[model samples]
Target: MNLSIRWKVTLATLFALACGFAMAGFLAERSLERQELAQSHRNLDVRTEMVAHELRPWLRAHAPRFTDPAFQVLVRELGAKALARITLIAPDGLVLADSAVASEHLPGVENHRTRPEVEQALAQGDGSDLRASQTTGERTLYHAILLTEQDGSPSIVLRLGLPIVTLEEELSQLRRHLVLAFGSAFLVAVGLSILLARSLTKPLSDMAAAARRLADGDAAARIQITSRDEAGLLGETLNRMADELRAKIEEVSEDRSQLLAMLTSMVEGVMVLDYRGRVLQVNPALERMFNVTRAEARGRKFSDVFGHPQLALLVSTVLSTRVGQEDEILLSPSSRCLHIEASVAGGEQENEACAVLVFHDITELRRLEKIRKDFVANVSHELRTPLTSIKGYVEALLDGGKDDPDTSAKFLDIILKQSDRLNLILEDLLQLSKIESGQVLLRREPLQIEMIVERTMAMMRPLAGKKGHRLVENIPSGLPLVNGDEERLGQVLSNLLDNAIKYTPEGGSITVAARHVAPGGSPAGGKSESLEISVADTGIGIPESDRPRVFERFYRVDKARSREMGGTGLGLAIVRHIVEGHGGQVWVEGNRPCGSRFVVRLPVQPSDQAAGHPSLVPTK
Candidate 1:
């Protein structure tokens, strides 16, 4: 049966007490019965002694008579006085008289020679035996004596027996008295046992409840110590344990909070998985990276969450080998590249470990690496083209083409032109590199955008006329002054017009427009005004896909056409660097119907750096 400790203890105590009392009562009863039996033996011994004394004279005087009434009568009288059965036996195994047997039955009595009491009396002078009487069929305690003469000649064998029932009757009365005393003591013990049990179990119950409270995260739970006993010591120990547990939990909780904060703030995505590959925990960063909620990600399989087989296999390998593994996985749709490091996260025991996958986004880094590779290749190709042309013309002049004056002159001019193209390419490359590397410092002066545009168009007009293109100016009068370097701003307009002049078809219109833009709300919760300048051309326009990257170094929409037209791809890159150096943004769009529009947005006031000249400073 199910039982609380209190009842169980109480019952156990009562049972032990009951068993002890019962054993004591039994032992006492046995002792008392033994003592009573010993006393009865004494009484039997004394009575037999007195009867033996009286029968000694009679035994010496008369001869033993078998089956005689006189002898039986004497035995009966002696037994009445002794309050026991009496038997007289001859030395020759004859029963002369028996008080329990009739005179006629005495003649038919069994031989006394084999009887234990008779044989013992005949041999040892006296003996005692407690057994059932063979003659009377009654339980009797027998004491026998051998009557002898002065000469030591054996005369009569006398045996006395008392019924065992007589001793039992007296013992029964003692038992009733013992029962009364034991019942009173048992009642007292039961009361005392209940009180003791309550005292002991109440503290244990309190401790158990407090333990439950502690398990439930109730740090305030405490036990009240009342005594310095074992139970009190236990309670005190428990209290101290609770305090330590609370402290450790708080410490671990703070550590967890810090860990969560770190994970949440990290740019790298982190995920934890169990041995079964089920997601255990996901931080906010991972949630954002995967575009899934933490709740939805948890308990889902790693393969299911990432849907990348190679990544899943990497995690599996780490789990199986109990080692660390790392790989780069490319995410589709957005084309983001992530470097994942997976490691076993727990003990070495089988299936006890987890896979901790830390994902670092390396998309930008990879893109930069590719750009570096492409730039090296493109520079080689761009340099190789003009070098090949110059070498061909010089080799032709040295190979007897120089003997023909006209051919030699033409070849020399071609070499010079190629050399000049190469020089132009190198100068543009140097300027682009200087602007990008923050080596060029721009002058910060409030200048008129109209003057910069007008000067750029004027300088490029002869080239535009050669191409038969019409140059149009769209600057509004009274335009706001722009804070920038005059040289850098002039370079920006010159590069745009150059690109338009080179790319525009003959007789196409090339327009340079300028306007003062209103203040747009900034992300910093502030307002700032900017100046917008756009160069629009009615030429073969840049494609929508290629516009975004057109300002990048060595980028060209029509590579063959640009190289044929002697256009170094570094021109627009230099313009972008110069414009952004002034903390401005530059972009290109479709001019619609035939060409592209390149727009530059510069703050009316100079910012941190014209990045067009990163070393620039603004003057009032």
Candidate 2:
């Protein structure tokens, strides 16, 4: 029922050939039979003429002897050899002699003149068509010929009847042979048809099998071409296609692997989604950043992963409009706020929108930005306060305070003190700015870190005594020398000790300790000891959330408290800058139970430098 093209073509060709052969065979047989019949008809006519010619003379000779037995014997003998019937008719169209029937029995046949053979003898002398004789009731082919006497007068008409029974038998035998030959040819055609179908279909079947293999993901499958025909050409084409397909698959696989590598290696968290706004893929960074697994994120809506209404709404809007959108989302429930800048990009493929969302963590950046803004505002206010006080004092002296020596002297002293304080504040601000702007050049030298802490603590001792706080030094005398600028390192230690003393309550304790940390492996040095100086105090400690930004310029955990203490809020900022400039780091941590500790780490000078700086411990 499922007739393929090849089978249909073969069958059609076979059928056309069979039809053509059958038509040609039938036509050829019919033509030969017609020719044979025509030849037989012609022979009959010739023989009939011959008999008429020979019998005419006999009839003339035997006319006088009308009952001659010799004529009858002659008629019988002629009929036996030719397989024809001969008759003799008188001139009046009456039967006078006969060979097939008795002549005396044939009577009342005078109307033979109207017959084709009789008419031919009387008129044109020849005619033909087989018909039954009216006189004898015999089916015959009649031929008539006129008889002439010696004087050229017509004597009798000789008629002949050919039964044609032997000719019919021969034609029947020819028909039987033709039928047998045609039947044999049909059987042979059927057997050859089966062979041809198999020969053609076998190659096609092989191609089909190879195609199945290819469809099953075997790009190596190929067809073997044996003959250089169309089928072979088809096989060759399939082989070439297979090779190209394999190459394409390899290229695609390589590209996919490269894409995956880049995505995974990227520091930025990436999330790709399909048109339905569901998460389709996410890189490892995103999984770690968002704290969501791929299994939990995949097939889930963007809103669910981010858990922000604004972010979810933005994604939905972009998807509905098929346009790019961006929004910042704040990740919550932590002291350190994480600001996420989510951007949607790319478009749809296959009627499904493809998009990538890049989440940038900007928490530190936002904090730093806030510090910068606050620093500018605080510096302005601090500068203005000093300037306003100096201006007011100078104006009082210029008006009335200047007339009275006592008042003028008192105002001028106040103005001078305010001016000096203003100068100090400006100088500190300038130095802090220089350190922050990376313009300060460090004069590195070998200095005893223990002496530096002692000098700073000594300077803050009077302030600590006034507040009833104990300023203690736990610095070891054998502590290593540190590589640093003496002036800047002293300023850093002074600021930390001052803040510790100021924050300590009455009877609270402040301790400055210096020790040598063991050699730690660093890229720049295989093993090196660092000078660790810590200034600790039992005071209101810094909150954990503000620890990271405590070194930022003008950033204060308690703005009112810092201002009242004459603190410009730039000390820690300047200290951090100077420490980093010395290839060191400074950090603050909570000192166990209600206190703060500031740690400054610097590379220790070589052992040879420590003995040379023995005088570094100035009178404390």
Clash count for each candidate, listed in order shown: 8, 0
lDDT of 2 by residue, 365-411 (tens): 78778776776787788788768888998888777778899988888
lDDT of each: 0.84, 0.76
The TM-scores of all predictions, comma-separated, are 0.84, 0.65
Best by TM-score: 1
As a whole number from 0 to 100, the lDDT of residue 255 in candidate 2 is 100
Q: Check candidate 1 and list the clashing pairs.
A: 578-612, 580-612, 581-609, 581-610, 581-611, 581-612, 582-610, 582-611
Q: Model 2 residue 436 lDDT?
A: 63
Q: Which regions in candidate 1 have their CA more than 4 angstroms from the true location?
A: 65-73, 89-116, 122-125, 131-139, 147-156, 163-170, 282-297, 304-306, 312-323, 346-351, 394-415, 441-447, 478-483, 516-530, 604-620
